[model samples]
Target: MTTPIVAFLFLLLPVASLAAGPGGVPLRSAEVDITDQASLQRGARLFVNYCLSCHSARYMRYSQMGKGLGLTDDQVQDNLMFAADKIAQPMDVAMSLGDAKRWFGNPPPDLSVVARSRGADWLYTYMLTFYKDDDPARPYGVNNLVFKDVGMPDVLWELRGIQVPVYGEAGDAHGAETAAIADLALQTPGLRTPAEFSRDMRDLVNFLVFVGEPAQAKRHRVGLWVLAFIILFFIVSYALYREYWKDVH
Candidate 1:
């Protein structure tokens, strides 16, 4: 019992670590709903349009994604198959690893299981936290509150627009006056309103969560059936046992 408890605690360690953003900032709620097929469809479109250029979801095949998202084969081929020729092909990028490494300093990591490794809240916060910084050293001229000095540019900038950090005075360890980011202000509005952008991000995160475990919904349904069967079997077994022992009694 103690061993099982210890193992369970160990498993929770990673989850606990993921709760905080950079500088121990608490992560915002993602509010993802994997069961929302319409949201998943919108997210799939967003992913293909924006994220697919840099990242690959190679663990998942186009055909599989289509089936999971309730998209037909033709729709997948016409819309989401920009990088792949066949529907059965995985969501691989056209860019080579060497090119990606040279361009981005490091190759963008595959996002097939990113939602599992990094929780939906983390991803959602990271997406919304990017703010403009005029630091010449930074490649993208942008930084994230969740991940400072992030290499990846804000791909959704066109939709979310330019945001600048508002700073406030704070005391450091040595009691010296210092500046800290108090909040983010949108310097320029984008194609989508803040509310719309947030909704889009939630949808994207939802789809990513689905991608992490495509069979999760099915698994849940199956588990419920299994539990029901066990209950029914126990009732029948107990009734038979009582009936057999009645003569002896």
Candidate 2:
């Protein structure tokens, strides 16, 4: 018969580690240039290659993306679009929600607002954090910190390879002299070394940043016009007020 203390310890152990643990990459630290045309174009290509199979930006039309990214309709159709889709149609993934759920146990979330909702940093970090663990219970023999115990596999594992984590201590930071530690370092390195992996992650993040606000260029141009109009209106109002005061005096 097992003692209650041993059972309590077993229950408490994994929970304690998971609560403060950190195996996934830190995503909130990447900085992306959304307005870089080359970067945006590269990002679009990468998205088509890696993510379009499972995820869709259902809110974005192909033509709108073409216009925003300065690509021609033919280019959007030939390169970026995977479906037999009309150029004017919104982006949709090949798989349906039901099919995705059946295969992966959950449908992949729509990416239309992921950048704005999760921010560029989180996305960037998440793309780089798929390490290999032979845990069958996890959906993909891997897990992510950005979306804990997510259903999606590390789809880019071929390029990235199996990752193992090196663990460390949290220590004194949260009060206890020997506080629980939840830090991770890379264990089994991948095909692309750390620097290359980081760059690819950045590219993906940059693309998502562009998707989040495709009209950013137009907004910047319109902003200047708006500011100019406001300044001119303020000057005219000041002159009008001065004229009225002069007549009264």
* Cα lDDT of model 1 by residue, 120-225, tens digit: 9999999999999899998989999988888998889999999999987778889987778888999999999999999999999998998889545565689779
**Model 2, residue 139: C-alpha shift (Å):** 2.6
For model 1, the stretches where C-alpha displacement exceeds 4 angstroms are 1-18, 173-175, 215-249
Model 2 weakest lDDT span, ten residues long: 12-21
* Best model number under lDDT: 1
Error of 1 at 191 (Å): 0.2
Q: List the residue pairs that clash in candidate 1.
A: none
Question: 155-176, model 2: which lDDT tens digit per residue?
Answer: 8876676666544555565666
* Global Cα lDDT for candidate 2: 0.72
* lDDT of all predictions: 0.87, 0.72
